[model samples]
Target: EAQIMAEPSGNELASAAAKGDLVQLTNLLQKNVNVNAQNGFGRTALQVMKLGNPEIARRLLMSGANPNLKDSTGFAVIHDVARAGFLDTLQTLLEFHADVNIEDAEGNLPLHLAAQEGHVRVVEFLLRRTPTMGNKTLPRARSPLPYFGVRG
Candidate 1:
């Protein structure tokens, strides 16, 4: 027989993060409920930032949430922000030193994801930081077209 683990509350810390309820999140964190905890879908507080709450994401980072944790699909917080074209969230994650070169399971980096969504400013911002990406190959292959498909 397999033992079943009870699911965490639907209104858990991450949910508070999704709602931008920093006060409740702070309280939860104080209780030591794994700041890096993922939801059933493997989404973290940083991934929830793409829901239009840069400030909440920043607060979570300050509270010690790991920015690099990925979802079940290997999508990092930066990837979510890039996909959603949330420049503010992207900048905040970058400032916290989130891994720019990290790829999802599909090998798509944040720049690649940004390009796929046609977020021009995001592409520029990521390109401007390529030298810091520490890998020469990325700067040379920074064109968005390679990652983003041609639109009709």
Candidate 2:
């Protein structure tokens, strides 16, 4: 009975997504749960989803999850996808129209994060899709991708 009066939140959805539990996630989506609701950590399901799973991203995006929503850390899911070298997941995000150039709290783009992590494939991909050309301005003086052969 108490469960009926509980406030709705995306904790369950985010948990399922973080665990890659497609079944449970689907169940929640079918119930018309708020796809954009923040979890206990103040992050949307798409924000905290398993970064390596494109299928999870696909389902969430199809279910009305906002790919561009930032978490408490001022990071969109693409930032994590890039930093973690999840190429397929990054592709999924792009297909959903996530802003490739979205800046993090530190004012670094996903490209910067991917480059910093030395994710060569992700860097190459971002370089092709990012619209800034070579003139992207950062809050800091230099790129974090010295090892990736990138100049500041």
Among all candidates shown, the one with the greatest lDDT: 2
Where's the lowest-lDDT run of ten residues in candidate 1? 2-11
| Candidate number of the best TM-score | 2
Candidate 1 structure lDDT: 0.75
Predicted candidate 1 versus true structure: per-residue lDDT over 29-124, tens digit per residue:
666666677766677766764356788888878877888888787888888888888888888888888988888997777877788788988988
Q: What does the lDDT read for residue 94 in candidate 1?
A: 81
Task: State TM-scores per candidate.
Answer: 0.78, 0.87
- lDDT tens string, model 2, 4-116? 53444689889999999999888788878899999888998898888899999999999888888888789999999999999999999999999987889988789888888
lDDT of each: 0.75, 0.85
How good is model 1 by TM-score? 0.78
**Clash count list over all predictions:** 0, 0
After superposition, the stretches of candidate 2 with alpha carbons farther than 4 Å from their true spots are 1-8, 133-140, 150-152
